[model samples]
Target: MGVTLFHHVGGILVVFSLFQIFFTPHCDAGNILVYPLDGSHWINMKILLEELHTRGHNITIIRASSSWYIPEKSPLYTSITVEMGKDVKDFFDEFIQEQLKVQREGLSLIAFFKLTKKFMSFLHVGHTLWCDTAARIFENPKLLKSLMDSQYNLVLTDPGIGPGVVIAKYLKLPLVLNVRWITSGEGHFVLAPSPLSYIPVIPGPGLTDKMNFIQRIRNIFSYSIILFQQNFVLAPIYNAMCDKYIEGGCDIVSLLQDADIWLFRSDFVFEFPRPTMPNVVYIGGFQCKPAQPLPANLEEFVKSAGEHGVIIMTLGTLVNALPEEIVEEIAHVFAEMPQKVIWKHRGKRPSTLGNNTLIVDWMPQKDLLGHPQIKVFVAHGGTNGVQEAICYGVPVLGIPLFFDQYDNLLRLQERGAAKIIQLHEVSGHTFQRGIKDVLHNDSYRHNMQRLSHLHKDQPVPPMDQATFWVEYVMRHKGAPHLRTEAYRMPWYSYYCLDVLFFLMTVVTMLLFSVFAIFRCLFCKKTKTKCKQN
Candidate 1:
């Protein structure tokens, strides 16, 4: 009886200790400054920031007013608008129009090479415009002085902008990076243990972990191009900005190398095999929550559909320049389907609007996906949208546009959870068939359900995991021990190229020396034989 009682008591103590470690809230709160990347990135991060605010941390977010407008005084957190000078934003607006025009042309079976060139041009223009905007922000003497005076305990930023690094350096704070997409920048490659061998780099042309020799070659080529664009084309502009703004002449590369933590908006199920270090955290689909009840009209519409269910189509915030012809084609297909469709169209209504389809400028996508009546999601394969679909166990019919969207959709198709219809090949019949295939095929549903289960089966919710790590970093003063030593290694040393080259040289010299000795011996022996003869 005594022994049993002792074991039981020990078990209880162990349980309590585990509970305390996992469930205990942090007593020490911090003042954190967050740098926002655009509207979509902000949407991805909003929930976690709110959770941190509720946990007693004072959060100051610097974002564009056009994307997220918070009142001057809010009880939850603070919002500081980063003013995008009038002409800059307008110029980007025009650039977006030109990009859309190119995409529209691409849909008419334009050559893939032409489309790629246009997309690259668009990316270059965007980076240049963004750099200019960032410079403007850093040049504001008042904003810079105020930010420096804020005395923040930590700084969190998206790697999409170089200004964040400059700001952090100027403020003399430990930096944490959050990437809102699967496609990574140079910082990720430099700071994390993510290598390109198995990890398909962003702008990947549909390469996967199960690549053959040819595919690996293609991946290497694509990775090289991406690196060139980031380091040569983009990094110089950022380095210039950093030098002009920061007092100590900060190197953007060094700043990223020393970053405290990396929060990735990705998960293992959606990504290929890759190495990751401790400081890296995957928080994919963290923004998804239990669905709120639908609005009255939407609820009624969904209910009216009955057994046919409904389909949801959204192309994300940045993809607003959809062509009219494609819209009409989609509408014609919707007209024939039994399912009612909710299309999130930001532009003028399609002339072919069917009775079975409803068009709205915006909708609560996650909530709709959670609804039992929502059967299929027609999306452009953006990371957030695809993750949400996977989270809700709703199969996707992906119409990928550009950048990582194609790669993301390819992964989904590989997993048997989705079907991808290239925009250039999309017609009424193709779009309808794609939707029907995902909907009627039992495999898609089963695969997506399995994915959802795997996603939810985590030790802690993603939000809590993010919150714990954020506060842990705060309590421990930046968690430097978690960072990998690879971050500090030189490029050549990091990949061991120098070591490999030295080995090759030694082996070559040894082979040459052996060959020379053998040849000399053969010649001397032949000479002796000739003399004897």
Candidate 2:
């Protein structure tokens, strides 16, 4: 009786300790100003905001007047609406449609160039609108005064858009970028050492880190496209904005590289091994959580699958549905499969609809991924979805449409955790075969499970790491120590090309001097021989 009582007391103590460790919030309650990029980026930003709110931080969001996802009133953050930005959401919808049209033309050099032009053209329009919006905010005196008076501890923002970065600079606040992408390219290219020999640029012609000579050359060529997009397409607009509003003026790339911390949305688990910076906190799957109990009807539907389990397919938020013909192929494929299919489809109901398939307008993606019954995830290869798939140990069948989707899936495919079927390759035969290959292949499940284990094995949970770093910036003002001074150097100085030139000059002079001495000696000896003769 005494031993049993002692064990019970110990159990209670352990339970209390666990509760304290997980549930307790840090004491600092900071005033944070957030300028978020809307659409899918807004989804992850909201997750980070919720965590900050839970920890007693007061959040203020700078949203455009035309933002669709971010509401004016929310318990999590007080919204500051900036007027005159376009209702920018529909632009992406159009861009993706055009990209799909181009992709369907299939693989050729001309087609590739055509698609790239379309992408660059799309970026030009997006950046032009953002520039106009930033100009409006800069022109507003009252808005500037209000932001200054609020006295934020730091500016936490999505650097996918430039206004937040400019705003942070204007306020002289310590900046923390919740970034996977900056205005120019992937965050790492600016933040860390990226050797093109190894680290393949995402969305470039190269897909994996291991590149041959030809692939490396292709990588360099593709990298130039990003540089062109940044310097020519985006720079003039941002530079003009900076000159007008900012005191002395600053360039967009400099302002971004000057950020105190980068909460990068990738880790080695999801990405190939590459060089990184101290301040880059990788909270790759931070938004993922343990699965909640399914709603009763959904639970019943899932249970009805018995031993076959289930397959969940979503092409992410941007795409409403695939092209009608492709959708019919996928729908017919699902009909033939033995497993239950819960597809997030809102397009015209396919005539090939199966009793085994459940079509919904939306889904709790994270929860469904986490569920033990989930067999394989058919995805559009978006960053959020890919990371979630990694977190949940679900193998993926990727149907890449456009943007970074193919390259994103390539990372998983290289690891043997996923398979990719191009937009043009989708057919009843291909879709069915790909699903079966991923579903039946034990290696796919085992490899994905390995990644899941590795991702979860971090000492601090990704979300906690993200929240800690945000508060750390507030406490320390800014982490200048972690930031490298390499960004301050000019390109020649940065790569030590100037130093190389100086060394080469010195070596050449020494060699010439030595040759002159030898020549003089030889001439004197010849003179002596002539005199002797």
Candidate 3:
């Protein structure tokens, strides 16, 4: 009788386990609303969307009508298009042109100021445009009600723009950020404790984790410039939106801090060690995959390099072509290299193009990077490309054009996996030297291979890890336990300034009291002596 009872209980347990395995996935499907920033940021967001869709989550994307990369129609997610009159693509194109012109003029005080002012103006205008669009979103009662009725499990957004954060708050949904760069600067500056002693602030002249006294001071000053942009420039614009839309007033930083998770797009292999929050999940290289078979012609060209291997070059999505003179110089460098080169350039073909070089308007960058025949990558140091290089173990010769590219290159340079030839410093000699150093030295490739190994060694792949956390938030409603309540505190309290003031005030009072007691005793003794006299 006892043996029969035990077998019956075991059979019931087996049935329960099977039910969970088959049915839990469908039950876990959630409705997620995404507000993604346009341009390169949308690329990362789409990757996450694909994973979630595969896991049976329903996704809805909010996109601008003029969004550069996001498609209005896709099987991955349904998009709600906002009618935006502005086309920031031209603005970005103009800025890049101006930046190139200024940078090529070489370093100067006037040139520096001109470029900085232009960059800041671009930032402000971008924020303002989003702010206006967010207001229009709030103003549409029908749209607002539709969103309310949909009852999304959470808002998945890139906090590089403020609209998503604002919308998340208004809807009172759980927030998860797909982030590396936030509105002001690196995501950590706002989300975690950044000690300037070691953690260098970006957009300054390149400094590393190791710094002297002068460099530390420069870091603080650079950080102050970031604060100026955040508080003086961006806050007022977003704060206005908050006051109008949110039931109670909210701030951008507070909304960001309240997020349940941050699917951070970098790891220690590519990023310097720094303080990170519990909720910040490192999903660097999540978008990377094994190389697919290349096109017949591309494969034929790659194989033609023989044992020397091929070098691939591309300037990323924004900068389609370099200045003609720079392009000609780069072509000249390729002419000297024994290895064949494939360059993605939209400009007129260089007169110096060698028989060993092929120039195309596009290349399958990730697939090419994964190819064993590829020796070195000549790229703009964008986050996606940098991480991809690490994923594929390809050493880089970076020609950083503008905005965060130099900083990204600096991280790899520090690790000895890549070399940067800044725009102002790029010439045939420098370009050729950088390429040859990476290709022949062997150490650059070895170091990058080590990084690739470390990056791939994780138990859960970055993409799976990112998706698990997104679902975790959906299941739990929000991961408030992982989030820090420090954001809720006043600035003085958060920094312990009030406690310091109180302790100092008490010590000062005690010292004054001791002096008074001594002074009173001395006065009485002097009076007695005078009376005796």
Stretches off by above 4 angstroms in model 3 are 1-27
User: What are the clashing pairs of model 1?
Assistant: none
Give per-residue CA lDDT, model 3, range 1-533, as digits (tens).
99999999999999999998887543378999999998888877888899899988999999998889999999999989998869878778999999888778886988877787888889888888888877778999999999999989999999989899999999999999999988998888988999999998866667889999999998998898899989988999988888888888988988899999999999998888989889999999999989998999999999999999999999988987888888899999899888999998988899999999989888889999999999999999999999999999999999888878998999999999999988988888889888999999999999999999999999989998899899889888999999888888899999999999999999999999999999999999999999999
Runs in model 1 deviating more than 4 A are 1-27, 64-75, 86-125, 136-142, 180-188, 193-197, 500-533
Q: TM-scores of the models, in the given order?
A: 0.86, 0.95, 0.94
| lDDT string, candidate 2, 1-533, tens digits | 99999999999999999999888754479999998998889999999999999989999998778887889999999988777556666778887887888777776888788777877777778877877887777778998898899999999989888988998999999999999988877889987899999988877773688788899999999899899988998888789889988999999999999999999999999888888989899999999988888888888998999899999999988888788998988899999889999999989999998999999998889888988899999998999999999999999999988777888999999989999998887888988899999999899999999999999999999999999999989989999999999999999999999999999999999999999999999999999999999
lDDT values, one for every candidate: 0.77, 0.89, 0.90
Best of the candidates, lDDT? 3
**lDDT at residue 82 of model 1 (Cα atoms):** 59
Which ranges in model 2 have alpha carbons more than 4 Å from their true place?
A: 1-27, 531-533
Candidate 1: tens digits of C-alpha lDDT, residues 332-369: 88888899999998877878888999898889899999
Model 3, position 171, has a per-residue lDDT of 94
Q: What is the descending lDDT order? A: 3, 2, 1
Which of the numbered candidates is closest to the native, going by highest TM-score? 2
